[model samples]
Target: MMKVEPASPQYFRSSSYSSCHDLFYEPDCPKKAKGPMLCVKQPSCSESNFDCSSIFHLQEAQDPSPSMSFKQAVVLVVAVEKLKKQVQTPIHFISDEDLYDLFLNIFEPEPIECETVELLDQPEKRYIYRNQTIEYSIRDIDKKCFLLQKPLGSPRLTAVHLQGPDAKKEVKINMAFYMCPGNPTQEAVVLGIAGENLYLCCTGESPPVLTLETVDKNVLGSMSSSELQPFIFFKSNSGSTCRFESATFPSWYISTSLAENERVKVSQLGQTAFTEFNTSRS
Candidate 1:
């Protein structure tokens, strides 16, 4: 003879609760799914496989899970860890917002692929590279503030998170410096060019503005007039201008750009660099 078991009774029935939660929908049994929905991090690892499995408890996989999978959880943890290490002054980061959305959905028990992988060992440097390179720390707030300096060059975000607290911030990132293309260069030493009129081009900011100072008579007499190229020098390069692609100010900064101070020091035995330039005719 066949027999049917009696149904058990519970105080909270699934049929009574209803709300606007998207998670409340039951994929398997809409009639039986009542009570609070399971969170991605809270899923039982022992009971299920795939997505949330990595972050979920390994021991929990032996039992059924209310929410989350292994793979999904791993992806979330990895992303969160990177953010914490990189915390700094606020800037517009679209990627950070996208990652937040991804975290919420990672636990649907679907397999997830982590964009970052834990390195076996720490790297020697956190390099931000492009046509040129600069070292940066992902964990540093101060460093980020310095990157906003003008003459803007378009930059990119390419950094990889490694494992450990002391672990290096990232592997290699491509750099993008803002470019004004046509701006006066600053802080250049006028190295006078050879010619009848004598054209002077600065080693630093091209077409450097200069202050004219007279070379001492004793020193002037020792060298040929052509080599001395006698002209007065100034401590401050006066008004000046140049194209952005120059010998100095080659990269980008996160902070405000400051005009560096120029100094004038003369030597008895050594020839001083002229900060200012003036023509013999003028």
Candidate 2:
């Protein structure tokens, strides 16, 4: 003895209801408005003719006193018909590769330098790619691995030293740098890490400021290519950690600060903190 109420035109258009079948059931349509209670005979219900308007007609023939007006019934019928059309529409399915490509298109990252590397020791294959300031080491572990370390210094000028347990063994591997095709800018270089792109932009304003910002490709390309310098990392005076200094901006060095929303900045040679970064490996 459950009573089902017909939904309005607005309800039919809403995304709240996914299919027309959900409208006829009292349990699914819990929020009922005050109106002629459309009683649906549960015993006579069948899958073939389960529409709300049809059920209302069957119930109306049985109980004539409490009934909807001709105009109200027409609206309900039209709404039900629209819902039926939406439900019957063919759904186009896409492959997993296609879906992935679609997502990549929507969230394409700004172009940055990338390189691929293969590890020789382990049974599982490893791939190394440079993204911004750090290099990522991806393995067959079903997850992403990050590997960061100081670049090896020149053997001729400075003797290369190793301290860890593996230092005793000489491990040699082939490496290649895949330079992204772009007119290099002297003012700034794009830094990418963890899929985020940042530009080391220099503004020739008062104080000769440098800022890291997320800028568009064209804006980054417009900056002075001649002034841009490769990021150089060197061991600190303590011999324990390293710091980054810009090649072009001789006296300016990259440092991290505690200011809100301003974590990275370029400070004058003698004024910045002992900014240290980890060389992570997967």
Candidate 3:
């Protein structure tokens, strides 16, 4: 027969304890501690009398484990989910409208993946609401993300222009200006392209800067359908994102007016291919 441990206070006794056998022979009792007088059977979960399993006391676990002071599982779950999101390759949208349309076509949730990007603002249908009359305000969250008034809107692309003496200069100009004020004016670089835009990233920067300014509307609106991969893709290499934006763009350059004593010879300024206006800034 099993009785209360000699180590336990003599006055201690639970009303639930029926007999010495009930204490030593209970299911889930530690088998390693067994002696000639003790026997442990599998927990009788199948029994109609069983209330719940008690192999592990969760309340006791909290006291010894990394006891959460916040006491909120939801917060932990949300934090873990956010970390998962940050670690994964970030998903970006070109415009609020296109993203809304993209979201609409998607049915399933959890690490959403879709091959084709759809234009959200459908001009054809007229039903409960019409965008024709609705003028919604929009804001760009740097170049990393865009915040739109509604989930739906027309597809618009972020743009970039690189004009300089050397091919490297073009990239250098793109790197310097595509971030916030505190960051240096140079050294930042573009890592990847998103939608119809370029994503400028740097190892030292907080987030990649997004290029804004559209080269062509049709190109961006139906951009996902493009089958051709051009060798020279400025926007594809440089623009696309709300999660990122430049602190300032490369300053426009002016034509040189060297003094008579100056040795520098005459040379053409930067071409207008980068933007509508010509640039002379190096």
Candidate 4:
């Protein structure tokens, strides 16, 4: 049975409030030795059916013995219900897109595997040696072009006779060769303007005219499809000279014109075709 002990001079100064310091027992009470207990209460329900559970109390625990009072049972029940509600609360999860974004923020994307090489553009300096016994030293010669621009500031690859002082200046005449990695034959490669993202491509037209396309060299290794074939060339070398044939059009090869200062174009490989170029790496 629980009884309300009126506030006394020992527990509290006022008689209106009741205290559980002398009424209740708590083994882990922090303020047991203190002057007065912090847990004070006002009479709410009748003494016959007291509802002390409605009011907040500190260190209000049952006795160490097996026996429990009505007040102690009510306090334990309320604490258990509050804990259950907290555990039963619904949890929210992130969407697929949001999860992917979070993953990207945490980890960096892997870089594409590709290679870059230099192609010296001196068409007249080419020497065709068809000797079979002299194994070809020029390998993986992807028919790449340098930063060749017209006077009008348009990006175009033109095979012109540049030598001596003009050829020495790398900025004026050069080609970037991109060889496909892991290929046993080393036939696959890309042609681009030296030191630029611009690549030379052909769309397999009746008379294929070279088109300039912008492609990030960093992503070149990941390209594998019909769309990428236009930019890919099959490299074949003889002595110091090499020829780049279009992967899209088997018969077509990248060729220069007989006349000087002519735009680079693709032509069907023939006896008279100017397809072979002298390759040298700087």
- Per-model RMSD to reference: 32.0, 27.0, 28.8, 19.8
Instruction: Assess candidate 3 and give its TM-score to the true structure.
Output: 0.12
lDDT of each: 0.27, 0.37, 0.27, 0.54
Cα displacement (angstroms), candidate 1, residue 129, comes to 36
A best-first ranking of the candidates according to their TM-score comes to 4, 2, 1, 3
**Model 1 CA lDDT for position 145:** 15
* Tens-digit lDDT track of model 2 for 1-282: 112333321111221222243344333343432333333324444535434333221122243454445655554565445445534648788999998999898997687988998886643211122323334221111111122222363111111233477343322211112232332222222333333344444454434444444545445344343423332222232253334445445556555443222334566656634244333232
Q: State the weakest 10-residue window (summed lDDT) of model 1.
A: 141-150
C-alpha RMSD between model 3 and the true structure: 28.8
Residue 247 Cα positional deviation in candidate 3, in Å, after optimal superposition:
20
Residue-level lDDT tens digits of model 1 in 33-113: 234543332234333331222322212223243344454455435534433343334677679779878987785556878
Q: CA lDDT of 97 in candidate 2?
A: 93
Candidate 2 vs candidate 4, lDDT winner: 4
Question: Which candidate's TM-score is highest?
Answer: 4
lDDT of 1 at 30: 31
Residue-level lDDT for 154 in candidate 4: 67
Superposed by TM-score, candidate 1 places the C-alpha of residue 270 at a distance from the truth, in angstroms, of: 15
